[model samples]
Target: MAITSDDVRHLAELSNLSVTEEEIEPLKKDLGAIVEYISQLDELNTEGVEPTYQCFEMENVWREDEITEFEAKRKDLLNLAPESTDNQIKVPKVL
Candidate 1:
């Protein structure tokens, strides 16, 4: 499971990363260590253990859906915005 320079190069190419020659050795060592650690995990003795998605036990704390009394006009909500366009809040273009 040890990672070689060629393996690192191939992975970098697939990921579109430009790994310099100086960085290849460190990356190879790091990747090799990770692979070795994961390989060791494969030797576990959890024959009857149940597969769990989370580490801790969890239960849904959902509340019962019920209509709640609330009073607020549309104009009151719109007045909080710094700028509005055609009864809609204006936001800056991100993309």
Candidate 2:
């Protein structure tokens, strides 16, 4: 798994990075080393091991949905706003 200057250039272009001529060689060497190190995982033996999706136990803890009333009235909330119409807060148009 050797990385070349062309490969580095192409990767830079794909990632929207600006790479100079001096940086291409260094990037190629670093990327090649990373690929070689990652390829070492092929030597691991996991013949009878079960694939685990999560490291810890997870369960859905759900509660019943209930509506609770607030102490403030609708008119009180509307009055807090600088400008309101039809019991709704008025805001400036975005566009």
Candidate 3:
């Protein structure tokens, strides 16, 4: 696919970039070369190759969720708070 000035301009607009007139030609050449290089992948022959998802042999290590006792007590935590009422920390009202 040929990268025209309009294509470059459209890309710039989509990317929220401000490109000058001087940068248009260079951008067009650069983008065209990149697309051409990537298009080489179309020449590859993969008849029965499995698509790769994860590059590494890694998986989720899940463990059973168990409730554990905490060292800090509720009363102690409440006392450390800047302000607390009704056994809960109080903060300034937000709009």
The best candidate by lDDT is 3
Indicate the worst ten consecutive residues by lDDT in candidate 2: 54-63
Clashing pairs in 3: none
lDDT of 2 by residue, 1-95 (tens): 89999999999999999999999988999999999999998899989999997787866778779888889998998999999999888999979
Query: TM-score order of candidates, best first?
Result: 3, 2, 1
| Cα lDDT of model 1 by residue, 1-95, tens digit | 77999999999999999999999999999999999988987778989999887777677768889988669878878888998878899899979
**What is the alpha-carbon lDDT of model 2 when measured against the actual structure?**
0.92
Taking all chains together, the TM-score of candidate 3 against the true structure is: 0.51
Ranking by lDDT: 3, 2, 1
When 1 and 2 are scored with TM-score, the better candidate is: 2
lDDT against the true structure, each candidate: 0.90, 0.92, 0.95
Q: CA lDDT of 48 in candidate 1?
A: 94
**Model 2 Cα shift for residue 72 (angstroms):** 24
Q: In model 2, where do residues sit more than 4 Å from their true spots?
A: 46-95
